[model samples]
Target: TTGNISFRNETTFGGSGTVTYRWLVNNVQVATSTDLNYNFTVPTGATMPYMFTVKLEASNIVGCKTVQEKTVQFNPFPRALFNVVQARGCAPFNLQIGNQSTNADQYEWYLDGTLVSTLHSPNNIVLNDFDRTYTLRLLVKNQYGCIQDEQSVQVSTYPYLKAEFDVANDLSCNGILDVQITNRSVGATTYTWDYGDGSPVYVGNNPSHSYGRQGVFTLKLTASNGFCSDIFTKTVSVSNTPSASFTSNVRSGCNQLIVRFRNTSINATEYLWDFGDGAFSREENPEHQYAFANTAFTVKLTVVNQYGCRDEVSATNFIAVSPPPQANIEVAPARVIKVPNYSFTFKAVTTDDIILYRWDFGDGTSSDRSEVTHKYDRFGTYKVKLFITNRNNCTSVIEEEVI
Candidate 1:
């Protein structure tokens, strides 16, 4: 199609007379008028090398004629056409767009009236969310001028499916876990589960599961809604119960007996000890002392694991402490004995298990017996010393003077 064409006369003949115009295309008279404007359609399939020409002739009343010619070259306007590929189902909608315009040198893409890309063909335009509408536009232009042709399309989008779940009662005793799962997902029609413990796969919205061993397990849940699918995972922990037991170095001893305690508890991290003598300890293994004699003490051990599982063991009257030996000395010789070689009998009187008795006669002589007879050769106020020991390796001593 050809647009309008105009001609102007700028001749000045001292004051221009009446002017006439004639327009011709390719030596053929096409229009004749006194006005300066003409409009016509250029014939299609015109060859190159100036095959068509337009000429304008102007004349005044003085019989002067002037002619002008211009070679016509036709360039058709660009047509903007495009094809859109719309993805209906899913959260991230992928769109493929292609430009099919003729004689286009540049292109622009718009989404929802906002400029997105400047390319001939743009692919994978992603959109998220559900029940939304978007407007896509393609603007194409040629290298001739600033003219542009545009085309728009409206696309409907939907959301993709997802899966999510949470677990309860994951911790249990003796490697038995009764797990209860809760599903919290949207846009899903089917669900599947992988318990990660070599167990059978489960298919449902919410399912109860059981584990046979104590360990950390990974739980997986997948949801699908025919068009898309998603997966969610979590970790669960199971603990082993703790066993509490202990041993002592010595169960019965004398006073001030230092007892060494050994803890034999399994799967225990923390320990508490009660020595039953108003004493306590937090160490795993400890040594304790019994201060008073003839006393019985009950010892207790409490253990705990990482999962807050606790166990306790106690031995009633597990320790016995005996008193030390006491030494009592007596002599049957009077202080006023006039005889120089008088014999004196010594004895020990105390409630204790006497293992040995040591007697010093104050004459550079010693003896080991409970009762002893010592003759004083010279009775000049002799001092006697007695030492006694018990079965608990405890000892005591006493002293007296004799004449």
Candidate 2:
């Protein structure tokens, strides 16, 4: 800071004996001289824009004196200094600021080249957006219209981590439970997985796992970005399957055959038996009867478990039924001599076990014999009919002519 002084000297006499000048600041004399030029510098560490009362005194040898006074104002430049409470944090971060400026009448703040606050001391600034870096600037201006250099600070932000996942092949059959896990987390660098089967923990973005047993299980996933971590969980269900098998007591018999079935299935709660002969049963052990002879029947057994898993077993030609015997007869003399009495010998031909037979000569005569000799009184023509029955109560009939 600099100040200047100007003074004029006057004398009544043309030739002056002596002329003296005196200058004082704030009512204190500091210089005495004959020269008209006066200059001084302000002291350091003094208050800015200081006011001073400067006086100039002029004296001649005749003792004539004059005095002049003026007031001068001095101002200094401002100093800018500040600090941020926190420079780096996660999103939605709050930052406290401190202003330590000197000789400043107003303050202005800028963030990322945009003005944010103008107060001398601003409130806490919150940054809720994600960015790699942010620039904060502060400007201080003094009453002298002099502005300080811009002061700046840099703040860093870390990315937020989220955990999410999905499961594939969750439902399985035949007691084989295999699952594929997919990770859907964002802004993560590492992952950890828990399958919830008392097994070892796994670490990966995607993985496949097999369960030793069947039931419901819970899975967990954790993701981290070295600064923040998040977790997610899900529930999965597994089903148990059953094995079906069966046995039968009788495989082949005569018509109207009765067969007993035994069910042999594992992990089953319900059963269904289908006998190929248009018969169905729900009993674990059931009895079925076949009515058609000379026919083969297929048997099927299906079992279901508590988890709604099912299995089936089938046997082709599991049961066979046979028909009763058929009877036929042949006579040695089909046509006997047309005399008063003729005798014919008849023999029974059969394919099955016959227990009883009845023979009629068609001439009002009958006999019960497998092989017999029949005598006909009238010899024009005679029809012989035979009926036979098997041990199973199945019967057959045949007719022959004797002439």
Candidate 3:
């Protein structure tokens, strides 16, 4: 902040007024400006623990002058960086991490997720980046006695087999079931995923499987690079039916929209929401606004149980944030859409010089014009949605069918 800090001062000539200006870097005799204003420039490379002093000297007469000083500082202790993952050689959290520059000696390591580095260390600790979380504290000696600097490595959770059992790894889902596991963890090999059925596959970490019948089963996975095993589980309640429900939308005052969920979960405390705004909401209940009118949005939710297992649910008509009357929505056939495949258009009713139009077709594919033309991508039926709006700022939906 050394550039130019401009300000004006007024003094009632008590015995003739006069003001002198002086600029000093680190309190050294730098310069003296004749005018009331000055352009001050402090030398760069002055990092933490450094100061810039600017003083204004005012004299009221014979050797009677008062001085006022202001000090400024830049670049306080470098910000903390944290990122830990399951994979080896993975980058630090957000890749902003680097070697500590605070010149320290003692280092401590902690596990089990974040902060709370319970164990203290006095040596250069070689970290195991495969765990859930790893944070370190470096005890450096300076003017500040044994200062501690910390960094974290978020080990990637990418799975080696693509699919992991949430209950028993060595478990089953019964009947015809497909399992989807995420691959973000780092450093893993040879995933032995068991569907607890008649057969198991030896492939990637997240793979789909099927069972011959419905009953109590165990799921398991043995992954290794010949060094150690990283296992994860779930209990199968395999019946003839799978039940779950998506959350409903809430309307708040001041045109605010609050959305929440009531799931059909056996056990869960975590959830992920895709509000369809290109922006995602992250709680069981989230609030948003409809600043823009006539918008349409698609929302998705996934819940995780205490067993470290997660699943996502997608419904065709989950959310609806549309644009500001860019297009109109309309349904065709006016009744039912036949299974298999069909196509249709969404039209706007009023003129108001309607500039544009968009159609959600509701079957997953939408038309992007004032009058859209679309068809069903797969067999079966859909609630084909057509949203319509006029240039004058009015919105409405027309639902129909294509059998």
Candidate 4:
């Protein structure tokens, strides 16, 4: 008669009766009991005069019942709460951490996939490194010795990406280093590349690249769907190759001019020369003789590479030629008639250039006076125009009149 009631109950039998029980808290009915234990939450207060009363009732065949009440003290201690603050870095070094419950008793840590440590305070903690998974958890026990729930997340990191290689040092080549890519994100599904050569190049691990010119480069690595990326730069030393030189000259002799071409291409296999004289020749060293006087000239060279690639260069050159004297003109038909038309002949003689001539008839019409005739449509008085040019580019002109 002085204890809390429960279902699995034991009591001393006194009289013949049907036994049942109902429980109440804060003076309100909450549960029915037929055994020793009765379920009910204690009214919330430690100092308050809260009570849990167990009732014993008895009934006989006469339909008459009698009851008695018993009560005991009900008290429960408050529970403590614990949580994790942050988890970072790789396993073993995962550094599992959490804040201790203000009145807590102990701490524990798990990393990657395993539990490794238990401590008494909220200090820095390291977890197990034996697992390959990227997630880990923390555990804390309150003053009442209650364990905390688990917390986890996935991390992206690569510890194997250390690089090693040498630089390229070629004059005619793109100066790229012999570097390599390594898959350090353990258990990664795929790999990507950015060779820092102006484009995103994709290849498997240990990939190599060549640059277009000479300079420093910034290389980058992005792995695991861009989950992690790293950048580093390196300077490459490159040198310039000197270009070969070419020179051509012209010399004059009796009735002939000799043209000469030369160069300093030790790597070239063949050379072509365009003398600008409407003539061309192919040889390492070339010589051409011309009987014509000095004229405008352009000397060209086509240097053929070992790979058959050719580069052509041309230089303009001028020559000094002797000009012939101008010829004297003679009018054959000194007089002519026609109010509206006249015809006459004119001639000139030049010993050096006989085929080159100009004619100036007394009429207003004229022609190259080598031995030319002209007619004037309106001939009251007329003046003529004559022009002549020789192969040496020497020119002579004459004008005449008739009435």
- On TM-score, the candidate that comes out on top is 1
The residue ranges of model 1 lying beyond 4 angstroms of the native Cα positions read: 1-168, 182-204, 218-236, 305-308, 334-343, 376-384, 391-393, 400-403
For each candidate, the alpha-carbon lDDT, in order, equals 0.81, 0.81, 0.49, 0.51
The order of the candidates by TM-score, greatest first, is 1, 2, 4, 3
Clashing pairs in 1: 91-160
**Candidate 1 TM-score over all chains jointly:** 0.50
User: TM-scores of the models, in the given order?
Assistant: 0.50, 0.42, 0.25, 0.28
- Distance from true position, residue 342, model 3, in Å? 99
List of clashing residue pairs for candidate 2: 49-74, 335-403
RMSD of each: 10.9, 18.9, 31.4, 16.4
Please provide, for model 1 over 8-68, each residue's C-alpha lDDT reduced to its tens digit, 9 standing for 90 to 100.
6453445567877787887888777644465656666643212357787878788888888
C-alpha positional error of residue 117 in candidate 3 after TM-score superposition, expressed in Å:
4.3
Better of 1 and 4 by lDDT: 1
Question: What C-alpha lDDT, on a 0 to 100 scale, does residue 311 get in candidate 4?
Answer: 60
User: Which 10-residue span in candidate 2 carries the lowest summed lDDT?
Assistant: 7-16
- Cα lDDT of model 2 by residue, 1-403, tens digit: 7767565544233565777778787888877855456575688767668787878787778888888787877777788889988788766677688899877877889888888888877876666676568888898887678657568999767776678988886666656788888889999999999899899999988988898688778888988888767789987667767889999887887878899998888889899999998889999899988889989999999998776788999999999887877866777765556666768889999878889899988889888989999787764777788988777666667888878
